[model samples]
Target: MAELNGSPVSLEDLQTLALTNYGHFTSMRVDDGVIRGLSLHMERLVRDSRLVFGAELDPEKVLGYVRQAVAHQSGSFNIRITVFDPALEMGHPGVEAHPQVLVTSRPTGAMPPPPLKAKTFSFSRDLAVVKHMGLFGQLHLRRKAQLAGYDDAIFVESDGRVSEGGTWNLGFVDEAGTVVWPDAPVLPGVTMQLLQQAHEQTTTAPVTLADLPRMRAAFATNTSIGVRSISKIDAVEFDSDDPVLDTLRKAYAGLPDERL
Candidate 1:
């Protein structure tokens, strides 16, 4: 069940959210009551809430709400927290004093598919930094790629530089065995941040469509998937058994978990 500010969501609540679904959100895998990089998750809420809603979000209040939502749940769960104002208007009159906090939890596996296949698409989001609610463009591109027989879509800039995946960040294992992230405008995902902290060789550099042919292997990172190998991007294929990918995965799994 979904909870709106520590209470069960009612029909009136759904109607209010449907009216104006403008907000920023974060999703993470919660094990029991602990989460890896819990501080980063709270930091994201504070930063995104200020940017999207023009108000500061008290981290303690958000955590209290999350704790309440997962109080009776057991095992791993996919938890999402949304920050928005129910009475928000479309134009200038929509500004609200305090944004509403909504938390929802549902049972889920530990990780997504091991390796993913992606197709390249020419698209970018409006605000690349904030993980906002509206994502029609990227979802549409992903659907189109799925219809064309690909697993998902990877977004590329007009200049041919690869940015990120539809709902994940891309990490490439170069020929030298270094984990290289594409130097482009994209949302810095929580999983990507954790991996970077785990491995010192993680670095950011320009990765273009032309550079894909030279990379030894690739992987995708996000809260839902963790670190997953990228089998193919369009016609180019990568080695799923690459040792570098395995090393990075082990490093990610070793990180300590924080309690809610």
Candidate 2:
């Protein structure tokens, strides 16, 4: 289901986002009536709106629209809140903007997705900090990886530093059991932030594909899939059932949820 500003969304309401694709969005998993990292999600939306559209977005108004969209739904589901202005056209997008909220929901997938076997690609998204609507580059790499018999793709910079997966943040467990987050220009995912807060032994450092062999295990984090183990990346196999992965998963799941 989809709604625009607390009402049903029509084709006209989505034209700008569909055609221009000049907006930012946040995806969250809503369970019952609560959400994990709801505040962080809203903060991302508001912050990205200002950076992408040059306008301020009311967090409370966006939250209200989300609550209204999910109020009737039951059980756990995934929701994406997109902020865009229909009045803004591609020719003159710099004008003062009044953004609107578009909330869409879908059924949640299996928790802890299957272990992923990813291939590395030399690609990085534009505006890596903001979760903007542009996805052609990310998805294209993912498709190429899949066609080559891989589950997904992990982006590596030309300088050989690992950044992130196509749609998630990458995390590593060193031999000493420290959780190492890649220090590169990537989207600050809410789940990754929560894991950093909950996991006591965590640090940020530049991780290269050469450094993967020294690591004990690796995993990916995102809202839909809380923590998923990475079985392999470009032939460097990791123990998908590693004990450290289990600990990280439990740590993330233990985080407190906020009421929507």
Q: State the C-alpha lDDT per candidate.
A: 0.86, 0.91
- lDDT for 25 in candidate 2 is 92
Q: Judge candidate 2 against the unseen true structure and give its global Cα lDDT, from 0 to 1.
A: 0.91
Output the TM-score of candidate 1: 0.96
Worst 10-residue lDDT window, candidate 1: 89-98
Candidate that scores best on TM-score: 2
Per-candidate clashes, comma-separated: 1, 0
Model 1 spans with C-alpha error above 4 angstroms: 92-94
lDDT of 2 by residue, 105-211 (tens): 99998889899999999998899999999999999999999999998999998888999999999999999989999999899999999998998999999999889
Candidate 2 lDDT trough over 10 residues, lowest sum? 248-257
